[model samples]
Target: MELKTVTAIIGIAWASVITTSAQKITMYSTTPTERWIEKKYSPDKSPVDQADIQVYTDSLLQDVIGFGGTFNELGWDALQCLSAEERDKVMASLFTENGTLFTLGRTPVGASDYAFGYYSYNDVKDDYTMRNFSIDRDRYILIPYIKEALKFRPDLKLWASPWTPPAWMKVNEHYSQKSSGIEGTDIGHNQLDPNRNVLGNVTGFKMQQGYLQAYALYFSKYIQAYRKNGVNIQMIMPQNEIAWTPCWPSCTWRPEDLAIFVTQYLGPQFEKDSIDTEIWVGTVNYPNPDYIRTFLKQKNAEKYVKGVGVQWTGMRALPTVHKEYPSYRYMQTENQCGNAENDWSALENTWKAVVHCFNNGVNSYMYWNMVLNETCKSAWDWAQNTLVIVDRNTRQVRYTDEYYLMKHLSRFVQPGSQMLRASDKENVLAFRNQDGKTVIVIYNPKEQEYSYNIKAGNKNFKVTLQAKSINTLVL
Candidate 1:
């Protein structure tokens, strides 16, 4: 994780200080609250690493103070989707114990479009019969990757979701990769469609009244399988992007249908199976407050759902939703391809995605496909748009500016740490925590350099933000 560094002369009143991206420290005070820059007192300083700077102060230097929750939804599918050799390089760059890349990831239950090819955990006989199911797919690679990740953060929280169920479970008679012959007919557990060769061999499962119960059983099997392999899942999104009928590995459900399935069947099934994982609904692409309203408005919605997961255009509408459902926690589940021209438009769009969601009460933000090829190829034909891209030709993985920008929050702002409010300062985004610790992450996505004042506690610091650059200051 080598960063670009330059010796720059920065001033604080009559004092001049040398700063670099590698090592930096800036101080400001309208009225010096107190100064303690030691290895132990500074919240930013590392306790495990013996040689890092520490800083501390006591008292609210300013009155404009606020805090919110923080978490991440990073990607791990690319690792599973790529060839073993290619996946290794991606892991080396991002999944290390001290890696600067990302910690959290999103994984599929079955063969997602991003995977090397189509497959599932239990590919044994009677996949949908719920009679003789098994998880053989994980032992070779998936579980190993998870074990390596646990070495970094033993308590790492994982949020699991599926793009598509097994070929035996869909009403269309096959998983996403295959074409649907019959439009609206239910594929029963005993039904085997020989014509759907797209998925190799798909014996479509029955969509009987007990389908929800069967789904619950499937989920239980998945949890048990992963647990046996020593991975504890924290949460699960009912389905990914349930609004759109995707080109590959997709499922669609109306808001009312989702509410009913979750509240009546899935929720109760989880309780019965003793699976403590939290159930999040509406992994919708955009923030459709109407959809959220539909779910939350369900007679006893609060009892069944943990929170709402949204992405894309939906994130833009969070402020309005936050005001209406302040009680419900919202999360930016997934997003990608934000004009990767390495410009402010890209930076500003990413910033807006983060701060807007946080300001409007979103506790977590995760990007799509954490690491991609140098050319950024995908089964869906998606291109290079990851925070980190692994170049196959050179066999070298490169980090993007977005990686550093996300670190401004993901790395510094620990889980359970609340986000505090300061001011947006037009382009500069500001947030603080309950402990009065503040992280003002700013980016000059434009061509011209800009300056802003961040007044916190009794301090007013002038920030000179360079164009197409990112800055994060803690006070």
Candidate 2:
């Protein structure tokens, strides 16, 4: 679908209202009394915590927090999953600044694994005629809902990624069954024996390093086309979850292949075309050590790609990866738990996501299938977890507990906020910003509540965190 997403740069100003009184207002907190104090803040401060801060001028937070929703998935049975009015309302909710929900996106080249079916811009019809291409599939469901959502946020910064190349581009030359986990009768046989090359899918296009370069340019053109239609395309990932190519929907590209494509092919094409969009790599399995090691080792690969996208299994490998590739941007590209055993499990996933990523040095995060059919019916053929799942029969979209947990961090913890070191003596992870603001998030996976000291600067406030809860305190 040709969904129009707009993005704007919004400014925030502190209101002028001050009261001079010794009156004390108290709320429940498990935080110790020695961790609060005023500090300095400067925009140019290296490691932000080192800057001078004007306590009164800056709030501990800024901007609306956000997550991605697959319009195709969410609006699949819109009339069934949500009333026509509720659909509009839900779409509007995404842009409400008070809800602090901002950011809209699109997959420039193709559908993601969470999608109902596999698709791309230049699908192979009869033969490989790349020039005779069109995004015909999206014209039906995904694009329409996205366009409607944009009506709410006229200035939504849109970014995109490609899940897989056209079936014609793979070694199997067919999109349906993949090598990773796809188990079905193969419609097309692997043309070559031993099919062990890192570039597994050797098609007319993806089969060669030079063809990969062409594919990059093809993507750039797609972005430009979208821009012509008023949607601003900001970034691109060469491949999504390149490490463990899934069968539901995915593609595989080894570290050397990615590096060769970036340093040798994609990078030059972007320069030649003057494509302003940034390239990210390894939209890889998050928390996986092998992918990180492989991608990081690729020759001068980091120079071209802006960030390493962590998703699914990739979440476990952040610490090791960050230590080596500290210079590149670390983004939580995709992660969620829709089918979590219970609300607590979902919240735990959120806690693990926010704390682990920030503590390990990830800057941004994105969730998969923002909304899904509660009953799990879509092209990905499988539904594990999601933030909002609507019952197709009842048309009720319930916000899971993870939604609230995400809010605690994403709503208050603004982007560009430097993650400063702080003590974690009580199973509590915390970070202090340059603006004399400290965000201490406590995760009590155990059954009992835990109280601890968060000493920083000169002032510390006594705090208490609920048992089996995630608490974020700004001091």
Measured against the true structure, the TM-scores of the candidates, in listed sequence, are 0.73, 0.75
Q: In order, what lDDT does every prediction score? A: 0.56, 0.56
TM-score winner? 2
Instruction: Give the Å error, residue 398, model 2.
Output: 1.0
User: Which stretches of candidate 2 lie above 4 Å from their native place?
Assistant: 1-81, 100-108, 125-129, 148-155, 176-205, 286-303, 336-342, 425-437, 448-456
TM-score of model 2 vs. true structure: 0.75
Candidate 1 regions with alpha-carbon error over 4 angstroms: 1-103, 122-129, 177-207, 338-345, 433-436
Encode model 2's per-residue lDDT on 183-300: one tens digit a residue: 3433323332325323433222354754565576667677676676656677787776665534544567766667777777777888887888888775777455776677667787
Give the RMSD in angstroms, all C-alphas superposed, for model 1: 12.0
Candidate 1 similarity to native, TM-score: 0.73
